[model samples]
Target: MWLLRPPGVYRPQPDTWLLVQALHDAGIPRGARVLDMCTGTGALAIAAAGVGAGHVTALDVSLRATLATRFNARVRGLPVRVERRDALTFRAARQFDVILANPPYVPSPQGDLPRSGPSRAWDAARDGRALLDPLCVNASGMLSSGGMLLIVHSAVCGVAPTVDLLHKVGLKAAVVARRTVPFGPVMNRRIPFLEEQGLITAGQRDEELVVIRGDRRDDQP
Candidate 1:
């Protein structure tokens, strides 16, 4: 898909594709209400719309990203609502049937997130769960009964924690898909830091990206 991304908006990469594939596999119900959190270029939102989602909402904190998504969806003539909001605090009157996220999971040396710039696309705190942890906790509340949340991130961030968090939040969570790819420029540059932090092996050059699914069972009240 051709998307119009400004300078600071994140370009879709392997992790993005992995989430898209997982979304496809999950199978969108016709007219499902879908939410794509941290939507950089609106790729997942567009995918949801293409798959027959009646209403798709894309959220990003970056103005550039929101504009790009708006333009991209408009060009495609897809019904997508773009909002500039932080995924951590975004609220909706009605819950969503599906939630998709490809948040910043790359472990960063800094303990805090960047206020602005391209690093916002991939830099999380030292543990790389800055966004992932919160998402695991809050996603269930955003999802309707029987809704599903699909999130993708590197295994370096500890996939088990994510699953456990989702489980603790009363959702059935598991890793549904995984793909190992060579480290990109960002990861490659952080090899030293990751090695020092013991997030990766001394010689490891590839990272495994996993798509985790958290399902809110129909039995839930």
Candidate 2:
């Protein structure tokens, strides 16, 4: 089950792997419907199915990534539905019990991205929170009642602001888990930006993995 991953698509992050492990540890029941947003290479979705998710839907904006996911799932014999659509534009007819997303958290101005490859994964809007804010706002609608939304991003994205955005969207969010990994290609550029923004003051640049969960609630404004 090996296919060439798209260039801009971020490969699976260590934190994402940790989050999946956390979900398994928390006992995400077998046969539960799960959605993996911004799915790259179908890693999380495939892992979910392997761990007992009844069904898994993997969504990504890149056609190449989706195709890769489809091929990966087929090769592994994992039942996963891969969708090629913008995460912001795509909608699910039915809500999901478990939703996982590892979006583009790097802050980049429009048209700033490289022509293609891993660079696409690194281009988040200015302030790094641009994509994150919208994702939280729409997350409420995408989740089933009592459903959980799991997301991972860099600490340089400003953890406080990210939490604030989630709260603004009516999702009670928390940092359920975190992991620090050696800085890589994505972090190489992001680190300096974060420093200039005063997001990080001192310390070596280490990739931060944050897991935020939004729990569905009945009470609504």
Candidate 3:
């Protein structure tokens, strides 16, 4: 799909496509409400709108991203509520039928998430769970009785932790999709630190991107 990306906004890469595919597999019931968290270029949001989400809310911390999402939705003739809100911090007005996120999971050398720059799109702290952890902990709180959450990230951040954390919170989480892709520029550059973090070995070059599904037990179909 064609998308408009402003300077410093994240370009849709393989991870984005994986999320889109997983969303497709999940299926959207007509009039189902959807939320796209950390919507970068609004690709997922637009697609959700296209798939018949009754109301789609796209939230991002970047103005450029929000504008890109709104613009894409407008050009596509879809109704999407684009907001410059930090998705992680907002209390949803109501639980959603489905929630999607493509958050920063790349392990960065820095101890803190970036304050600016393109790194903001893919940089989490050293452990790489800066965003993932919170998202898992809070997911059950914002989902409807039978809602589901889909998130994409690299295995380098430890997929088991994601599932384990979600399980702790009473959500049935599992890996549903996996793809091994050559390391992109960012991951290639972080190889040394990743090795130091014991996330990769000396000769590791391929990283597996995975889509994890978390659904309320009572709502599983």
Candidate 4:
């Protein structure tokens, strides 16, 4: 799919495509309400609409990202509502039947998240859970009964922690997909820091990206 990516907007990469494939595997119900969190180029949102979602909302903290998504969706004639908002604090009026996320999970030396710039696209805090932890805790509240959340992140941040967080919130979660890819420019540059943080071994040139699936039980209120 073609996209209009402004400067600083994240270019769709492996993690994005991995999440997209996982979203397709999840099988959207016709007319299901969907939310795409941290929608970089709105790839997932457009995909959700293309797959027959009744209402699709894409949220990103970056203005360029939101505009890029709006334009991308417009050109494709997809009815995707684009919003410039922080996913961690966003609350929709109605629960979504499906939520897709490819948030920033890269371990960064910065003690806190970057408030602005391209780094925001991929830099999470030291542990790489700056967004993941909260997303897991809050996702259950955003999902309707029987809804599912599909998110992608690197195993360097620890997949079990994410699964445990989802489980704590009552979502039946597990790693549904995995792909091993060589480090990109960003990860490759962070090799020294990553090794120091114990996120990677000294000679590890590849990282495994995992797609985690969390399903809200039908019995949930």
Candidate 5:
């Protein structure tokens, strides 16, 4: 798409396209209320608007990202309300019919998440669950009855934990999509640390990304 992201905004990558494709395949309910968490350039938010959502709320903790998202949405003539807020701490007025997220999932050498810099775009705690854990748990409540949530993360972050967490919250959750990709530069640099953490084996250069889908069917287990 024609996205205009300034420096410091996270660009949509393969994981993003996969989630978009999943969104398309699943189809958005007409007049659906949608939320795009950790929205970088508003790619998914614009996509939802383009698909006829009643409302699209896109949010990011980074000011630059929120600005880029607004600019891109405006340039595309899509209706997306952009906000500068952390997804983990956002308190929406109401639950949404659909929620999309492509949060940071890359393992970093840092003991804690990066406070600032481009690293914030992809760095999580050592195990890469800093955001994923909260997201999976909090998203269950953020979703309305019969609503759906789709989030993408690397397998190194533990997809099983995500599914289990969502399930514990009474959302029917499972891995809906997965793709094996060669490690990018960030991942490549962390191979040794990842191996040391037993997340990967030595000489491993490939990683699998998975999208977890959760449905709040009236909180039925």
Candidate 6:
């Protein structure tokens, strides 16, 4: 499916490549149940299906996004289930073997940015950790035993805090992959803080991609 460059919606970020590559490298088995949260254009979901995920459920808060996902899936002839629902309120009737998400980790400003497609995708509430926190906290309930959750985000948005939250919820989080890219408008002030905290280093600084893995446990928090 073609990705429409709509106003106020966040377009696909470069970090999405990181997720696709990592998942491809990880070798998800054919017919494995997978869930893609905040699936913007259904890129990751489509990739997963192409790479042999048995069933893929792509969820997003925006109806436009869901439509895009559906269109894309049809174009590729990949059978993906697209759902329009807020990630926070989405309740899975069954657990999945793999859960993937690329949420809006860029903290939103008090005033809204220009109503662009990319803006809508990137802006998040409260330092960009709002969505990440809830996802980690609720992951155990949504993932089956021994299932895994793969998430990608920037280092500037408090990666440590995200790791801590995941651990607190009984998930063993780790940085599976990372890459630096040219920082853009959505990444303005946060870069300095990330550098100060050693999350990003000097010389050619840019966005960092982090992949966190959540281990399954019956006694999860």
Candidate 3 C-alpha lDDT tens digits along 1-221:
99999999999999999999998888878888899999999999988888889999999999999999899999988989999987558778789989999999999999998988999999999988899999898888888888899999999999999999999998989998999999999999988999998999899999999999999867432
Candidate 4 lDDT: 0.94
Residue 172 local lDDT, model 2: 82
TM-scores for every predicted model: 0.98, 0.88, 0.97, 0.98, 0.97, 0.85
After TM-score superposition, the amount by which residue 109's alpha carbon in candidate 1 deviates from its true location, in angstroms, is 0.5
lDDT of prediction 3? 0.91
Clashes of each: 0, 8, 0, 0, 0, 15
Which ranges in model 2 have alpha carbons more than 4 Å from their true place?
1-8, 109-117, 218-221
lDDT of 3 at 36: 92
Candidate 4 residue-wise lDDT, 1-221, digit = tens: 78889999999998899988988888889999999999989999999999999999999999999999999999999999999999878887889999999999999999899999899999999989999998999999999999999999999999999999999999999999999999999889989999999999989999999999999999987
> Candidate 5: which pairs clash?
none
RMSD of 4: 0.7
Candidate 2, 45-162: lDDT as tens digits = 8888888999899998787789888988888888999988787677789888889888877765453433466656657766666567777888888887777888888787778887
lDDT of 1 at 165: 96
Q: What are the runs in model 3 whose C-alpha is more than 4 Å off? A: 219-221
lDDT of each: 0.94, 0.77, 0.91, 0.94, 0.88, 0.78
